[model samples]
Target: MPLPTGSSQPVYYVGWDVGGWNCDANPASRDALVVLDDALNLVGTPWRGNLRTTLNEARDSRDLIDRLLGLCRHQAQGAEHVVMAIDTPLALPRALLALARGDAVSALGRSQENPYLYRETERWLFQRGITPLSPIKDMIGSQATKGMHLLARFAPHIAACGQWLSDDRTLTVVEGYPSPAKRSPAFAALRQRVNMPATLETMLHQPTPKQQDIQDAWLCALLAWSLRHAAQSVAWPPDSMPAEEGWIFVPVDSLTPPV
Candidate 1:
C-alpha cells in the first residue's frame, strides 16, 4: 500500500466531499476534506466547513488559494504535487446541454442510456451495477455547482475526460465517487491492508452525516492515491467518453454490487 513516487518531491492526495454552498443553514451538512501523503498517511486533521466563508474572508485570488491550502493544515510546505478528488459532478451531460439550448434529444426509453440525465461515465457506472446520481435529475445541483466553483478557482485546465491540471502543473483535480467504494469488499480489504488510521476508522462507525462526509472524503483521497500509483485499482474513463462530460473515478472492485 506504500506508494513510491518517481519524483523526489512528495505528492499529496486530497478528498473533498462537497456540500451546499452555505452549510450554516443545514446542521447535518458539511463540506469535508481530508489529506493524505503518498505513503497513505493522514496529513492533517479532517476539515469540516464550507468554502463560502473562506471566499468571503479572502483578500484576493492568491489569498483565497492560501486559505484553501490552509485547510490541509499540516500539508508539507516544500515541493509537492497535489491531486484533489472531489465527490460531485464536475460537468453537465452533453445532451442535457443540447436540450437546454432547444434541441431534440432521443434515447429516453432506457434508464442507463438516457442522454439528458446520465453522462457516459455515469452510464459506464450503471452497466457495472453502480448507480450514480445525475446532477440534473438529482437535487444535488447545489453540491455539483459548488464542486464546479472549486474547479474554476483551483484546477480549470482539463487534461482528460475527468482530470483538470493547474496552470503550473502542481495541482490536479479529479471527480471521485466514493459511495460504491465505501460498500465494496475490496475497499474493506484495502482498509485492512493499508492499516487505516484510527481517526478514520472511528469516523466509519459513526452514523452521523458529518462523520459520513469525513469518511467519504478519506475514500476520495484514497481514490486520488490509487489514480496516481495504483492505477489498476481505479476505473478510468474510456477515450470515447466526451471531455465536456467529465468522468468519475471509482474503485475497480466496486463495479459489481456486494451480495
Candidate 2:
C-alpha cells in the first residue's frame, strides 16, 4: 500500500538546546535537537547526537557552524524558510560585552561574571518591552546561578542569528525556556510576570516528563515563526535601532495577563 504525502508548510524552524552531557551521564554528552512546524507543533521526535568533538577540541568554530548547517539541511528539507535557535552563546552585543569586561559593583558582586552580564541584559530587555526567555530561579536556589550562565551564553547566539536574518526577516533564532516550574514557585512567578505563556497544567500545577531544555528549544522555534510573520517586533541595525534585546515567543493567548 502507498502512503499519502504530507501537505507542505510555509516554514519550518528547528531549535537545539546543547547540553554538557546527555539526559543520563551514561549516554554521553550529546546535543538535543527539536523540530517544530509553522503551526508551532512538534513535528518530529527530538534527536540526540554527539557535540562536534573536533570543533570543541580544535577550537574550530567552523566545525560547529558546519554541524548546525547540516542540521538545517535535514530539518528544513522542503521549507521556504528555516530558523535555528541554538542554546550556546553566538555573539554578544558590543555594549554588553563591554560591560562584562568592566568592573561595576553589581557586575563584580557575582562569583562568576557571566551571571552579572545576563542580569543586566535581562533588565535591558524588560525595559524595552522585550521579554527574554530565561529560567526563573529562587533567591536561595543553586539552579539560579546555572540558569544565569545559560542565558549569558545563549542570548548572544540568538542576537547573532537576529543579525543574520535581518535582511529577509524570514529566519530568526531565539533563546527560550519552559514555564511553570515544578518545584520553584519563585521561578514560576517570574515567568508569569514577564507574560510568558504557561500551559494549563503548568499554570495549575507542574507536570512530569520535565525536559525543560527540550521544551525551551521548541519555544525558540515558535518565536522564530512569530518574528518572521511580524507577530513579534524585529529589531536589527541601521534600519531598526540596535539595542540589547532578547527575543521570546509568547503565545498570543498567553500575552494577556491571567485573571
Candidate 3:
C-alpha cells in the first residue's frame, strides 16, 4: 500500500471531516483532518478538533487560512500545492446559493430544475448506484452550514489559486464523499485485512464510524492522491460539471471499495 510521487511538482493533500454550526465537532465527535505529502506519507501530523475552534467564527475566517498556510509551509518555500479534499459540500446548489444571496423568491422558481433535490453530481453518483445525502437536506443538519460558511470565507483564496497541481498555487480545494464507499459491503470485508495506518483501520471497524472522522480525513487525502498521481477517477456529466456546485472525487476500483 505504497503511495505515489511520480509527478515532478510537490503537492500535499489535506482532508477535512467537517463539523456543525453549533460548535460541536472534535476528534471524539467524528470531525478530524489528516495531511499527506506528495509521496503519500504523513506530513507534520494529522489533527482533530472542532471547526469552530479552529475557524473561530465567520469573521474569524483568517484563522482557518492561517492554519492551512502553516500546513503548506511544512513543505519548502511554500512551493507545494495543498489540495484540500473536504468531506462536506464545498458549494451549494445554484438555487440555494441564490436563496442565500437574497434572491429568496427567485430561487423558488428554479427549484423545478433539480426537482429531485439532489445536485447534478449527486444525481450522477446515483446513476452509478452510489448514494450521497442531498446538500440541501444536509444543510438543515448544520454540517452544510459550517462548510458553506468556510467556502464563502475561503472562496476568494481558492479562486486565486491554480487548477489541480499548480506550482504557483498554494491551495486548491475540492469536495469529497467517503460515506457511500465506506458503507459498501466490499469495504466492510477489507476492514478485516486492509493495511492502512493501524489507528485508522481499527476505527473503520467500529460499529458506527461516528468517531472515524480522522480516518475519513485520511481517506480524503488518499482520494486526492489517487486523482493527482494516478488519474483514476469517475467524474459524471463529463461535458459540463459546474464549478459552483463542486465535484466529488471517488477513486476508481480499489479506492472505491477496498479489495
Candidate 4:
C-alpha cells in the first residue's frame, strides 16, 4: 500500500542531523535522527549514536542502516507515507562538462571551495544564495560519506521510487539544510529560545551541544511536510532533478529577502 492522499492516513516527517563516525559533538556522532507526526509532534524519542560502534565488524554500516529502516518503517503511517528529510549532501558532484551526465560519484576530479565534486544541487544552492558546506571537504573528512551511504541504503525504500530518487505520494526523501533555512527573517525574530517545535526540556535531555542537531533534524522533517503539502514549489520537479545527483529542498520563501 502507498501513502494515502486522502485524510485517512496520518503523514509523518523525519529529520536527520547527520555526522561522521568521529563526530564528537553529539552522542550519536554522525547519526542523529528525529521523527514528527502530522500535528508537528515528536513521534518518539530521537535516536542518537554511531551504528559502527555497536554493530561493529562487517556490515556495521548496513546494520546501522537496517536499524534506521526499522525505525522509519515502524513509525510509518498507513501505507508508510513518510517523508524523511536529511541534512546532508545526497549526491556526489556532477560533471561540469556539458555532456558528462554519468555518475559523478567517480567523476573527473575534486574541488576545494566549490561543490563541483559535491552535486549539481550544491551549485544550484549557491545560485540561490544558500551557501552549503563543501561536500568534497566532508568526503575526505568522513561526513558526506555517511550521508551518501544512508542515501544508497534508503533509495530502495522510496515508494513508487524514481530512478535513484523519489518524491511521490508514497515515500519521499529530501535533502534539507535547516541551519541556513532557519536563518531567514521568518525565523530570526524568536527571542530566548531555539526556533523549533520541539520542547526545551527535550532539547536539554540530550547533550546541550547536540541540541542544534535536534533542531536541524526537526526542521528537516518540517521541510519535508511543507514540501509535501503546502509550498510544493519549494522543491524542484523530480524530472528536473538530477538522476544521480540528489536534489536539496529549500523553502521558497526562505531563500532570500522578500521583494
lDDT of each: 0.78, 0.40, 0.56, 0.56
> What RMSD, rounded to one decimal, does every model reach?
3.4, 10.4, 6.5, 6.4
State how far residue 92 of model 2 sits from its true place (Å).
4.1
When sorted by lDDT, best at the front, the candidate numbers are: 1, 4, 3, 2
TM-score, every prediction: 0.88, 0.46, 0.68, 0.67
lDDT, candidate 2, at 146: 29
Residue 174 CA error for candidate 3 (Å)?
A: 0.5
List candidate 4 segments past 4 Å from native: 1-3, 7-9, 22-29, 51-79, 96-115, 138-141, 157-170, 185-207, 232-241, 257-259
Estimate candidate 4's alpha-carbon lDDT, on a 0 to 1 scale: 0.56
CA displacement after TM-score superposition, residue 190 of candidate 2 (Å): 21
Query: What's the distance in Å from true for residue 71, model 4?
Result: 6.4
lDDT of 4 by residue, 184-215 (tens): 54333321232333465467334366566666
Please give the ranking of all candidate structures by TM-score, highest first, separated by commas. Answer: 1, 3, 4, 2
Compared to the true structure, candidate 4 yields what TM-score?
Answer: 0.67
Task: Please tell me which model should have the higher TM-score, number 2 or number 4.
Answer: 4
Residue 19 shift from truth in candidate 2, angstroms = 1.4
Against the true structure, candidate 3 has what lDDT? 0.56
Better of 2 and 4 by lDDT: 4
Q: Give the candidate number with the greatest lDDT.
A: 1
- Candidate 1's residue-wise lDDT over 121-239, tens digit each? 99888888899999888889999998887677766778887988766666788999989888777667665544455766667546476588888888898888888678888887787
Worst 10 residues of 3 by lDDT: 160-169
Could you give candidate 2's per-residue lDDT for residues 1-259 as a string of tens digits?
A: 0111353534556666555432334243345566655555555455555444422442222233334445533433423445655544333334445557884444334322244344434443444444443332222122233223433432223334233332323344444433312223333343243222344226223423434455555445544444554342333222243334443333333322422
Q: Best TM-score goes to which candidate?
A: 1
